[model samples]
Target: MKIAILGTGAVGTTIASRLVEIGHQVMIGSRSKTNEKAIEFVQKFDRNISNGTFEEAANFGDIIFNCIKGEFAVGALKSIEKIIDNKILIDVSIPVNTKNGMPFTLIPELCNTNSLGEEIQKNLPNTKVVKTLNTMWSTLMMTPSMLKDGDHTNFICGNDTEAKETVKILLKEIGWKEESIMDLGDITGSRGMESVLHLWWKIWGSTIGTFSIKVVN
Candidate 1:
């Protein structure tokens, strides 16, 4: 599969490297074609991995991974809206803002009633958007098994049933089991998932450890 990762940050680079390791074609998309981080990523990986501007990467991918920071996501996608039509977009971003050097915080206007996932979906009505992996760190996003026993849970939500199923397969490839993945109905459910980040931040600070949630029956 040809995948486009729309950010050159830690999350996007980590996801792109993993996908490339798994034999998928990956392009790290950034605002500039000469982005130093993006260039370094391609030089570090095999020929199957590359880098480009946002629009160029969008045009190159069969599936687009919106890995940009939550606050910048909509504007980034809008820049390449024409090329991403009908593509399945796996959104793993959270709408977080940092204030006065404080720990990460969610944007008040985009939480509860609205979420980054829904906003992206609304902005790109023609794109198939599925939300997942926003609740955990980028490393854990692909290697959940690194944690003790890997029994933790992850959530996904999207209006398109088919798109969700497709994302499920990709999740499995990265070590998520069917039983460990919870589908919380449609896109609206993202509100709950996004909200979980607040608690997640607190937990991360309290324990100073890597952890994720598990849905116990």
Candidate 2:
């Protein structure tokens, strides 16, 4: 699968490396065109990684992972508006106010803090946006081995049935089993995911450390 990760930050870098490791064409799209540093990072990480401008990466990916900071997400997306429609976009963003090494979720009038995922869906209208990978830290996004107590959950929510299934398939490809993943349902359900970030942080800071949660019956 050709996967495009926007933003080139920690989350983007982690996801890109994971996808590349298991044999996928991965590209990193940044605000800046591929610079020497970007080239070096990608080359060092994996030979499969291609760095490009926003529009280039959007069009290059079969599925685009929007990993930009929430504040800049809208504009960053708008820059590549043409290719977004009808594509499956997995939004891993949260509205965060990072002060003193902590991020607090913002309160939105209608949609709460998680609406950025749905908001992107609403604005794009044609894109199939599934909200996932926002609950846990990027550390566990790819490597499930670090999961402490081995009991953690990654939540997904979306409106479209087909889109949700598509996302589930992708998640499975990344080693998330169907039962281990919880489908919260509908884009509005993303609010719960944002709240889980609080739980995730607390767990990370506590005894659990970098482990994950799995729902077992």
Candidates' C-alpha lDDT: 0.89, 0.77
Best by lDDT: 1
lDDT of 2 by residue, 101-190 (tens): 555544353245546777777777788888998877786877654665224677888888898898888887887756667898899887
Top model number, TM-score? 1
Any idea what lDDT model 1 has?
0.89
Candidate 1 on 103-198: residue-level lDDT in tens? 667788788889989999999999999999989998998898888667888999999999999999999988888888999989987898888877
Model 2 worst lDDT window (10 residues): 105-114
